[model samples]
Each structure stands twice: as C-alpha cells, then as structure tokens.
Target: MTSVDLHLEEQSMVVEEDEFREGEVPKRKNKKKRSHADLGEDAEKRGICYLSRIPPHMNPSHIRQILSRFGDIHRIYLVPEDPNIQVHREQASGFRGKEFSEGWVEFSKRSVAKRVANLLNGEQIGGKKRSSFYYDIWNIKYLRKFKWDDLTSEIANKNRIREQKLNMEISAAKRERDFYLSKVEQSRALNFMQERRKKKQKTVGAESDGTEEPKVIRQFPQNRPVADGGAQTKTKLSKDILAGVFGGGS
Candidate 1:
C-alpha cells in the first residue's frame, strides 16, 4: 500500500472530522413518536383502583413484593395521608380503626387489578395476629371504567329520581290538604245558609201569627130581678147562639 505523509500545524485551523460539505444531504435521525392509542393504553394499563381497609403498616414496597408474584405493579399508593382525617395520621404510627384504610394501586393491566383482587381477597395482611385486609373478597372492588363522570352521573340520576318522587308525594299531600280545606269551607257555608233560612222562616211565622184574625168577645145577658130574689142569679146564652158556637148540637 502507498502511504502519503500528512503535515500537522500547532495552533492552526484544521478541517474537523465528520464536517459536512456545503449542499451535502444531512443524516436522518430516527425519533420514535407514540400514538394517542398507545398513550391511552399505557394509561389504562397503569390504572389504579382505590383500596380500603388496607393495613397501614403494610407499605407500598411490601405490598408490591407480594402482588408482583401475580402481575407487574406500576405503583402503590398508601392513599396520601389526609391532614383533615385524624385516622390516617394515627394509622401511620401502627394503630388501625374499623373504618377504611384506603390506598391506590396501579398495575400493568386492568386484568392485574382484577387478578390481585381475586388472589388477595381473603388473604391476611397485617396486625399482631394478621387479619384479612378486606372484610369480604367481593368488597375488594374497583371503580368501573376509570371514569368518575360515570359514577357521578349515576349518583346524580338517582338523586333526581328520588327528588321527583318526593315532589310527587308532596304534591299529592298538598292536593289532599286543599281538598279537606275546601270541604270544610263548603260545610261552613252550607251551615250558614241553613241558619239564615231558619231565621227567615221563624220571622215569617211570627209575622203570620201576628196577622191572624182576632178572637171575638161576647157580652152575657143581665140576670132577671126575679131570679135575684131566689138567692142566686144565672146568666144564660141563647140556645141557637150556643148551638152555632158548639158545633151545631153534635
């Protein structure tokens, strides 16, 4: 092979290796771009369902170590301690209450959560004697479909239907109350009319009695002087007049 001698100058400018000439095509860089579906799938795979009645002493690492046997675990959250709730602070120190020991767990797939739930359903986690974390296997459940809107919508619809039924009952009660009130008013009015009619009839009867013909007064004949001498005097009405007054000699 023929060799060419190259001269090097100290502190002098030299063409750099990998330098491109003018108008030369640049090398293409391969950058991978993720699709929307891929991103969605990634989010779904690592989806978390809030777990309750979890043993507080059971940390995320301990839980992951146990659950990793079933499937890949993306993350474990001991439901962020809430300053508002005193129980969380207490549980962090080892004491647990009867209420929920809530936390979230993200797995490699939705099936992983289901699988973990199935496997850990009746399994024990913590305590001096180590009792089951979940009260029931079925109770170790998930928020369906990872959409809070669906849950809220269902709750809202239930409330609305309940309100509607309550409104109907109230309306029916109001109608019944109004009907009774109307009936009472009608009874009062009828009684008042009857009283007025009775009063008018009494007044009319009094007036009719006052307008009736007056009774006639009759004068008795003077006793005869001869009759007075016999120690008693008697007054006598004529026979015809007596007959006419006493039903014509019945």
Candidate 2:
C-alpha cells in the first residue's frame, strides 16, 4: 500500500477513537445526572410507618409478606424484645421463638404507607384460626416528616450510650472487687501479726516461769529496857568511886 494511503487510514482511526471517547463522556454524564434525579425523587416519595406492638413470632419477613400486598416495602426494622423478658416468657410458656416488641417499616411511596397505617390500625389480623397471630391487633401509625436516616441515627446514638454505661459499670465492679480483695489481705495480715505476738508472749512466760525462782524477805527482833532498881544501884556505885578518888567533898 502507498505511504500516503497508510497515513490517511491512521488519521481516520484517531478521529474515530476521539469521537467514541466524546460519545462515552456524555453518556456517562447523563447517567450520573439521571441517577441523582432519581435519588431525589425517591427520597421525596419514601415514607415510614410505626408499629407500636409487634405480634409474637412475627419476624421482618412475615411482616413484609403481609404488608407487601398493599404496596412495595423498601425496608423493615423490628426491635427485638428485651432478652430478660424473653427469657422469662420462654421459661413460663415453654415456647421459644424470636419476638419483636416494636417495629418500623419503610415504603416506596408516602401515600401507600399512610393508607396501610389507616387500614390496619386497630384491626384484627384475620387469618387461619391456627395461626398464632390471627387474633393479634395491629397498632400501626404513619409517622409524618420522619425519615429512615433519623431512625438509624437515633439507634446509633442509643447504642453509643449503652456501650458507655456498660463500660462504666464494668469499671465500677472492678474497683469494688479490688477494694474487697485489699481489705481481705489486710485482715489476714492483721490476724497473722496478732497470732505471732500471742505466741511470743506465751514463749516468754514459759521461759521466765521455768528458769527463775521466788524471792524471800528477812525479819529482825526488837530490844527491851532495864528495870529501875538496877539502874539506881549502878548510879550509887559510880558516885562512891568518884568521892574516894577526890579524898572528900567539903
């Protein structure tokens, strides 16, 4: 083939690639814009309903089956019964199944949600007599100006608070247990010291009683006085001697 013809074919291929890219760009942009518009419309039409009391053994799937007859359901969230209460009921009745206390259902259209709430509110759940929830009543209400994001945010905030409280309780329990253990240790140490001191005293008393003897104190007698006549004769003898020595008392 000629070089000029080959060059022309290369140019044509480049132009075609550019045109393809240009076409793809606008298609992608249009898709993004359409998605955004659809999302806005969906948000405006979305509605939420509240169920005050959920019948026992009624799960989200069961609720969807029943409510789907009226309109399309977007989402279902049923708050489970308290674990403590469920345990008590299970023991008393010997029936074990997942139970919900309350629930919230999201519908694709606001009008359908409102209609379902009105129709089902205060109405008996009529079904086969053998159905567990046949006699249960619906306590549904349409929530105005409420959104799914609001429910999710509220649930997240509650979970955060519950986690904080559980952490605080665990810390408090640990502190109390540590304090109790410390007190027990102190009491044990004090008792040990007292026992050692008592033993030391007993040992010292035994040594003193065995090695030492009792001390004795001495006593003396008293002297008596002479008679009066013996005292006078002695004085007369002393006076005669003194007269002989001095040759006379003129």
Candidate 3:
C-alpha cells in the first residue's frame, strides 16, 4: 500500500497558553506539529535521500552513518516492504535480483541537503561510485512548498479548484450547442420523412384510381462486334417497327 501524508497547509499559530494551568503540559508543545517550510528546510539540509540497487542484507545504519558525516540526520527509514514482494518471494533463493533500498537523512537546513546532494550525487564513495548505493534511483525532489502534501489529495484539490470553473463553462456551452443542433436535425429529419410520406400517399391514390403511368421505352446505342471472318458487322434494325414508330427510312 502506498502511504501518503496529507493535511499539510499554511496555518497561523494560535497562542493558547491560558487554557492550561502552570503544572499542566502545554497543548501546543504536546502535539506533534510541524510546518511545511520547516519540513522543506529540514529535507534540504539533512536529506541525503537515495535509492539503492542492493540487497536487504546491506544494513541501512552503515549508510546512515556515512551520511551523518555530511549532515545531521533527523530520521532514517528503509522501505520495509517491497512493492514486488509477492513476485520476488515466489521465486527460489529470494530471486537473486536487486531490491530498492532507499535512505533519507534530514539535514540541519536546506542548504546542506543541496550542497551535499550536489557534491556527492555524482561523486565516488566507499571505493565504488556513490551511486552504487541508494543515491541514484531516489525519487528525490526539493519540495518547494512542503506545506502542501506530495500526494493525490493535494493535487486533486488544486485540480478541482482550477478545472471546476473552467469545466462548468465548457459543459454549459456544449449543452447549449447540442440542444440547438438537435432541434435543427430533428426539424430536417421530420421534413424529409413528411415529404416521403406525401409522395407515397400520392402514388397510392393514383394507383387506386386505375390511372397507370405511361412507360417510356429507351433505345440504347448498340455497337456490332467483329464477325468470325475478322470483319466488323453493321447493325440490322427492325425495319417494320422503325417505319411504324418514326415514319422515316424508305
């Protein structure tokens, strides 16, 4: 399951010291509260965030210690469960493939995370390339506005706020256009159907009155084909029918 942190926002600090007596713990101090700017600053300074293409056997503490030389570590955690846990566990001998080992160290400030990241990102470490560990595939990004969560909720909220107004405008225009076009289409279709029905009614009425329409005979131009002797033949017209119809050729 993907874990996400939400409820991050720019909030004003309220001084509520009067609610508690002198002996009682302050409510503000008791609650674990941190600001976006504070987290961002901490991540920048102390975060030596990295993803390693190594085995779980490789301890995270050793890597953490190495990173401590660069800056103070607020907290370090290894992604305990693998996303491909099921597939890998199914194979024999633990699949013998690389696992994702990520490391994060919260520096004292943003400058430190930046400085260390810039210096050691492409630099060598532990006799091999520093990239041999988790530094390479780290989904490391400097969160500019840490007050907002790096999650779908935050993204969805921003998207909804932005697109809600725009989408409504588009939807309204689309509905109006569809209604207008549909009316025009319906009118045209109705007119065509009505015209066809009228023509059919007329034809039926005429047929019922026994007034048969005259049939016109058409004459087609016929070209004579070549005879077996290899000579083209001329057309032999019906003289009697032609004379009766046209009153022409002697």
| Per-model TM-score versus the true fold | 0.35, 0.68, 0.32
Per residue, candidate 2 scores C-alpha lDDT tens digits across 208-227 of 88587767887888676677
Instruction: State candidate 2's TM-score.
Output: 0.68
- How far residue 40's Cα lies from its native spot in candidate 1, in Å, is 7.4
Candidate 1 lDDT tens digits, 1-250: 1110111111011211111333324435358898999867687666455677565344444455556677766544343344446565566755553222555566768887877777666565432354344333323555556632343355457558968998999999999999999999999999999999999999999988878778899999986666445645456779989999988885
Which lDDT value does model 3 have at 14? 16
lDDT tens digits, residue span 74-191, model 3: 4443434454673666474565543445434445556656666666654544534543453332234333333222333654675578689889999999999999999999999999
Report clashes for each candidate as comma-separated counts.
Answer: 1, 0, 11
Clashing pairs in 2: none
TM-score of 1: 0.35
Report how far off residue 236 is in candidate 1 (Å): 41
Candidate closer to the true structure by lDDT (higher is better), 2 or 3: 2
The numbered model that scores best in TM-score is 2
The window of 10 residues in a row where model 2 has the poorest summed lDDT is 24-33
